[model samples]
Target: MTDNRTDPDPVADERTTLAGFLDYHRETLALKCEGLTDEQLRLRAVPPSGMSLLGLVRHLTEVERGWFGRRVGGRDLPPLYFSEPDNPDGDFDDLDSTDVATVFATWRAACAESRDIVAASSLDATAQRRDGTDASVRWIMLHMLEEYARHNGHADFLRERIDGATGE
Candidate 1:
């Protein structure tokens, strides 16, 4: 996106913006699901936990919407992964095979919107935390990076279980 796509140097300082953080997570997630089919991606790797690669993708999408859309975007969007009459983990619980395409598309869209919001503001810009605490865009970027890195760790193990593959 920075006209550096062809840069062979893998060590380039690519993360100069919060959008970079978002892109970093997206790439990490895609790696977690590399070469996986919808069935493999949705194959709830852990039964009792109901955590699958697809679920994580769906969950991350919801997280972005919740944090950036509802909280930072300051829109009255509905909550994800939580519903009174519905299952508590909506993102993980929904395993409808037919919805795979729709879910992935939605995830990508949410990420784009999140990037747009970050691109429109200064990383030092402040926003209220979902809990009404104060935070800067930089804080959100760092938090999401930490979160995705941790989840990607879990995803590594889960992905290996799906089909042995590993990396940062």
Candidate 2:
């Protein structure tokens, strides 16, 4: 298969570099999952982990919402996949009952909204956490970049296990 990932430029400014790296990792996650059947996407190829490509997408959706929607925008939003008191691991654990299209749509929407939020705010812009702690947009972006990188690593393994497909 053809490689589709866009490399982040090394000479870019801080903001451009951060955004490019985040986008690169995001695309890597999607590329790792491309062309797989729904059943394949949901298969827990790596035993004892309970992680699927679909679950990764769902979890990232919630992560995007938590950081960008609720924390950064201060919008009153309900939990996307799981609640605090019940089924907190719904994103990864409850994949069998999920509609693949809906999960993908939710993830896409969350990512778009996150990009919009970041675009409209200054890097130094601050937001409040649930615990009343402060977080800057820069920090949120960096945290999200880290989150995507870590999960994309999981996606790499899962994809490779699901099929022989590999590489960025």
Candidate 3:
């Protein structure tokens, strides 16, 4: 097996902008989730803490749809959580959707969509959330960055459990 251990600090340089932070985090999360099989990636905690690398990817995809596509782009896309099913964890409980090819394609699509949306708008541009509250593109970028950071931390532990290797 190939060793995937990284430098442990994915973002060593200062991300000077919110968009930069978002990009940095996206990369960091991808790193944490990398080099694992679908089985290893989808392993959940006891009774399922509803946590997994694939789950995080799904959740982040939904977040991208909500924050960037719907809010920032003014697109009325279907909400992935409330309308898709009744699962409180949203996209985290995908035990049956374990097809690696499908999950990978979906994740890549989500990342591409998010990048396009970010590229199309300025940081100061404002958009309303589903609740009709205002959100700046800057806010979405920063929020996603933070979200990825927290979840990637979870992924770190999960990966460690999957294999003895740990770092970054």
User: How many residue pairs in model 3 have overlapping backbones?
Assistant: 1
Give the distance in Å from residue 94's predicted Cα in candidate 2 to where it truly belongs. 1.7
Model 3, runs deviating above 4 Å: 1-16, 46-48, 80-85
Candidate 1, residues 60-155, lDDT tens digits: the string is: 888888777776778786865557576768887767654777877888888889888876777777888757788987888788888787777778
Query: Could you tell which candidate, 1 or 2, scores higher by TM-score?
Result: 2
Q: Provide backbone clash counts, one per model.
A: 0, 0, 1
Go through the candidates in order and give each one's C-alpha lDDT. 0.74, 0.86, 0.72
| Highest TM-score model number | 2
lDDT, candidate 3, equals 0.72
- Poorly placed runs, candidate 1 (over 4 Å): 1-17, 84-86
Q: TM-score of each candidate?
A: 0.82, 0.93, 0.80
Off by over 4 Å in 2: none
Can you write out model 2's per-residue Cα lDDT over 1-168, one digit (the tens) per residue?
456878999999888888888888888888888999999999985567788899899899988899999888778878878887788888888777789988888888888888888888889989887788998889889999999999988998888888888886
Rank list by TM-score:
2, 1, 3
lDDT of 1 at 148: 82
Q: What does candidate 3 score on TM?
A: 0.80
Best by lDDT: 2
